[model samples]
Target: MARRRNPFDIFSDFEEMFEEMLREFEKMGPGEHISGPFFYGFSINQRPGEEPEIREFGNIRPERGRIEIGERKPLVDVFDTDKTVQIVAEMPGIEKEDVELNVEGRELEIKASRGDRKYHEFVELPADVDIDTARASYKNGVLDITLNKVEKNKGRKRINVE
Candidate 1:
């Protein structure tokens, strides 16, 4: 008889959801964090790191919006391409309508609120972005933003006339 897949297995997809949850809390706001009592059985050295690096998402922080009964902090993902930078934020239990994206000079700003909770975020952009032509879109509890990189003149050339 063939063995059936166990949905409750530590390595199963169900457990992956919790892993995602932990990542979300790390990226969203500046607060305390704790590495999980993970059930996956992944070796301590094989995993990312045992250290719980708590980061405070500071710089132009937004005011405390509101708080709900059972709400978790959001998650954020940042990726950069050759000529563009993309930012994706996951805000579950919150609607896209409550999220806001803004680009100032060379910085990217993101704000989100759900129920009675609000989160403010700021990301500094590389020196290759044209804020005027940046684009942002939100769908399926995720916010996607693409910024175009600016073109600059190459380094100086030496001209010697003897």
Candidate 2:
């Protein structure tokens, strides 16, 4: 019989690898400072009849045996309804005034930065939304946005060329 593999083993392996990388950083000269506000996380979503979706968020990335830090991508969820589209994002330790949003057609860009925390995410809306009707609220590290969906064209329009 074949041996059964343990799912949690991967997490332990990841921790060991991460520690090794940190030790490599310690090898730098004493004058070098290794400070960090690093963030890394992931989310798994499984719908009723669809394949599981895995999403990675945060500012940490391993490239060519080195860790790269950049703007964190907050975990976001988009809900589409017949009349509206709602989006929720998790952005901790950020103020409402620091958040900036831009919407054009079916795309929405969210950006926020304060002190050492910075977040940026581009969301592709499921349907057309009325930019003027968008509403947003933030509280306790969560940002919620809602937009009214544009009505679909009833029928095809005939265009005449001169």
Candidate 3:
């Protein structure tokens, strides 16, 4: 003789599993927008013996009437010429008064918040610069920052290791 399984028992097991899955998804938080299994508009590249690198191209949620959860990091590019360092950043839908910039040592920090959008980013400069001499301008949702390089002798100190 063989043992028989009840169909109702099998259905009950499936229902429990589905409910568990839903509970886990709810933990991600209410009003959390996710387009798919992975964050939309992002790509990942994996190489042998190396960690995966993720790059985000844009936001997938509807641009209008979307509520963001936390601070977003804006895309920025830093470059240097012979005498100056330049930083260009894209911050859409932000006003001039909503943006704040700070430079300490070789690090540059940018923060902006307006309406329902927030952005923050930190950049390490290629060379030491005079923060007081930095000039910045924002127009049409873009920010351009320029800093003059400090003289090498004045920018570095020789520490006597005792």
Candidate 4:
């Protein structure tokens, strides 16, 4: 007979794995210093008929008992609608003035910096958006953005043959 597993076991397993990794990271040689402001996190997406999607974002990477740090990639979610595209990002401890956004064609770039915390991410939009119709708001560590989709030309242009 097969044994059933508890759903809460997932968190315990993840905690144990994280602790083991931290222990391994601490085995570095003397004079090797690990700097602060390191961050690592992951998000899980579950759908009714699809496999779970796991995404990792952070500036710090744990490799061979060493850590490498860079610009943090903020966790983001994009929703495409018939008339618009919405983007939401989580960036805590940052003021609204510190954030910057740039849109080009079907791409969007987000960047922010505050003290020791910095974030940067480039997202490929699902459709072309009207740059002049963008609206953004930030409150309580969450940034919300909406842009109108550019309408496609339905009529084909005729070319004269030589």
- Better lDDT candidate (3, 4): 4
Error of 2 at 106 (Å): 1.8
| Local accuracy of candidate 2 as per-residue lDDT tens digits, 1-162 | 976668745355456547755866778798986466776777778789986666668887555677767889999998989999999999999999999999987899999999989999999999999998889999999999999999988899998999
What's the TM-score of every candidate structure?
0.49, 0.75, 0.57, 0.73
Regions of candidate 4 where Cα sits further than 4 Å from its true position: 1-27, 47-51, 62-67, 154-162
Better of 2 and 3 by lDDT: 2
lDDT of 4 by residue, 1-162 (tens): 966667745454446547765875688779876686676887888768987666667886555545567888899988889999999999898999999999988899999999888989998899989989999999999999999999998799998999
Please give, for residues 118-162, the per-residue lDDT of candidate 1 as tens digits: 556677675568878778878887788888888777899898999
How many angstroms is residue 57 displaced in model 4 relative to the true structure, after the best TM-score fit? Answer: 1.6
Against the true structure, candidate 4 has what lDDT?
0.83
**Model 3 steric clash pairs:** none
- Each model's lDDT comes to 0.58, 0.86, 0.72, 0.83
* Candidate 1 global Cα RMSD: 12.9
Candidate 1, number of clashes: 4
Model 4 / residue 129 / CA error / Å: 0.8
lDDT of 3 by residue, 35-64 (tens): 522212334556689875554433322233
Tell me which of candidates 1 and 4 scores higher on TM-score.
4
What's the distance in Å from true for residue 77, model 4? 0.6
